[model samples]
Target: MSKKPAGETLYVILGLLFIAVIGLRTISTPELWTHLAQGQHNAPISFLASDSAVNTTWLYDKLAYLMWSIGKAPLLILLNIVGLVGAFVLLLRVSEKWGGALSQGFALLIAGHLMFQMIDVGPEVCMMLFIALFLYLLTTQKSPAVLFGALIPLQILWTNLHGSFLFGPILAGLVAAQAAQQAKPSGGRKKNQTNLSGTLGLLAIALLVATLINPSFIKLHGQVIAGIQSPAPVYHSSLFIEYFQIPALKPLILFTMILGAGGLITLKKRLPLTLTAIAVFGAFLVWTSPYHAMLFAILSLPFIVLSLTAISEYIHSSLEQMLGGKAKLVPGIMGGVLVLLFIASIIPAATGCAY
Candidate 1:
């Protein structure tokens, strides 16, 4: 096999460096203290606090405490950075089949900027990492046994780590529907495709069951329901900010949306139904609260990049014809501009400006 392109490797390294710079910011979320305190207790549920009926993020708390005890806030910051970077890597892999590294890198930078705004030295970091990993496994795994087998344990762990674990079953169900839809067009392997879809559906159910393996058992889901109906008072402050606070970075968000739409309209082929479903789900979350903009951004990054890649290809083709041999310089200049934009995006956070 021929060696991979040097520019791809450079793009990856540069992307990672940008991520590190963004992740290096000060830990500002006050919830980190509450989580650290909870981790010191043996009981999974917080008996004294009225904020939560069940400790949905007990495992994350425990892990956070461990990291804090070792190196204090610095260690926790490192963990947050790791989660952010790991999520980006998985996003890179997921989008690789649809686009080139340059496009993937650019898309992820947009998503990461949005996602990292909400992340701190708390369970949110773990939630982001788990979400990315879960999406990767669901979309790529071919074998039903392997897919379900992996997701069940992951769900169990995620349920203990964060309340957003409900997304696991939701995603499974969506992917299962997509699989079933694909089966209709598959001629000879229709039966196999149907089986895969059926397995995914079952996996969705299994994930729901696995969620009960936590400390609160069935009561945990009740808490989820209650929280949905009326969010806990602890979230009131965040809820207010997320719902009403106009983000200064809204321009970037709008830019990504325009780019994604432009790409979708210009696409040469139909976008996959699974991606559409996921993106819709993500949009719904953001609609519920701006705090979830990251969720929408990250979940839709692959789709966005797919569009960007198509647009880039179209542009590159035009340039190739116009400039011929001199067209090679364009990618380098684009790469430099990408780096500059990444730096500019983080300037607000770096200088203590609020979102």
Candidate 2:
């Protein structure tokens, strides 16, 4: 195996920090007690029976039942730890493939925010791990057929695990739409247009069919529709929490959103299709549900890093011309110092004194 780079080291450090904070919160809080109560009320058989038994996803309850059956808290804790670590690794791999070290670091920071919510013994944690894996495969794989084929089973599992599974197909449809829009007309023959249209059509059909593979089928779909219509009370009751809003005042959320916006403004000249798809998806997630605030933050890192690199290149070229030589390293050093200070401040806040 090749040696890890400095950037990868930084990501690992940050990832460990995230795990530690989440683990501490998971062990110390009353969140697990609530989940246990919910689990007892739902029961394991409800997953295979009917949606009338529980308000939450069947898959999550099943997993909790299995853990509880072990007759030990240690086993449940172990499984949760494993899932959390899996999510971190998947996030690192996806970010590394999309952007290099700096982007990976940003992804880890965003993952830290997610870990806070995920520690509460909820279905969203499992859904996030699967979502990360899906993104990793989508970004790194070359064959659309292979990727979508593999994604079918994952979608079924996701449907059982969390209601947020609906986002998977929605995301794929958005990507297909982006691809279709970006396709150019080939010399009046419309060859490119035809091919793009066909691909998008196939993707749409596959996504639709994938949802049917779940055991609940239409019931699952109906539950999702109902949830959307009714809205969760947590969002209404906890408006003061950062997780309940777009985090317009929070430094990290504001920074990530600005980065995503900047990417769309500047990098559209180069990676127009990718940046446009990201912008649309990120904006939709932020606008539609407060629960998805961390998803937007996690997904925006790659685009932000790409945009910053382009801006840095432009600046370096302009300075080289004006100076007739190399410029000083003051800016880079200052930027690094600022980043360190930001991390220092954020990490402590994440890992509270109770932890």
Candidate 3:
């Protein structure tokens, strides 16, 4: 493998630092105590006279408990840092693959800011890591051994880790559909496309099956679905602002609208269908509860980068046509605006005002 350029390495390190600057902090979530308490039961499934309390996050709780045993809350905080940083790194690497440095950096910073509040000792943090890993596998890995070996096991662990294990099969299915939609039977490429589509389809099915490996088996699905569909009373209370409905003109919502516009403007070039699907799914999550804003943030991140790239290229080309020599100035100004936006979004957290 060829060595990465020194500049690229420095860029990556800076990106990691940006994520950590926003992500690193002391754990303050009350849910951590509940998770640790439940973890002490030593059972993934519990039978009760009234209802079976299927522990969807049994593995996470167990691991959290193990960390707590070793070094108490400090170790759990370390695990949270490692998991969140790892997830952001995977996302940044994937974003770099498909977009310019400016777009990817902006996307990562926005995502980190949105996810910052979620940085705590909980299953949701673990879910963030798994989501990034699954996205990495879907986008970058094509080898059968790696895809199946990694994805199937990932689903199993994810099922036992969090209720969002359903995302594995959902994302895989979308990828398979995207492949099938793009495939055309013609020459040597036809066989390759067919195999790729078929492999991804099988992978989706395998991932779905893997979710049943948890102690609750098929019943786990019902439990998780019900949990998601059930509205928590906290959503309606005033204790947290995350559950509040986002204003239409909020900066993040406007950014999302811009991404949608970018996708529409670049329709001829064709954005990935899977991205559009995931973005829509993310919006649905936010609609259900603003507490899931991080879901929208991370899920829409790759698509946001791609949309920004397409929009940037279109603007550059259009500007070059109108003002051949001065086109670069416009994009440079836009880049500066993005940096300002990032700084503004993170200022509250960075200065400890958010805490």
Candidate number of the best lDDT: 1
lDDT tens digits by residue: candidate 3, 1-355: 4665554454445556666666656766567777887788764344654655677788888888888999987777777778877887787666665576677766776676666544555777777788889888898888989999888877888999998899999889888888887877677776777789899999999999888898879988998888877845523334556665433324665567567577568745666878778887887776556677667777888777787778778878888999998997875676667666656655766687756
Candidate 1 has a TM-score of 0.85
Per-residue CA lDDT of model 2 for 73-167, tens digit only, reads: 76676676677667667656655534555445555555466435434555656766776676666555546677667777787778777777776
| Cα lDDT, all candidates | 0.76, 0.59, 0.74
Q: Taking the tens digit of each residue's C-alpha lDDT, what string does model 1 give over 123-171?
A: 7667778888988998889787788778899999999998888988988
Instruction: Give TM per candidate.
Output: 0.85, 0.73, 0.86
Q: Candidate 3 clashing pairs? A: none
Per-residue error for 75 in candidate 1, Å, reads: 1.8
Q: Give stretches of model 2 more than 4 Å off.
A: 1-4, 11-16, 19-24, 27-56, 71-78, 81-85, 95-98, 110-119, 178-200, 235-251, 272-275, 284-290, 314-351
How far is 270's C-alpha from truth in model 1 (Å)?
Answer: 2.5
The TM-score leader among the candidates is 3
Q: Return the clash pairs for model 1, or none.
A: none
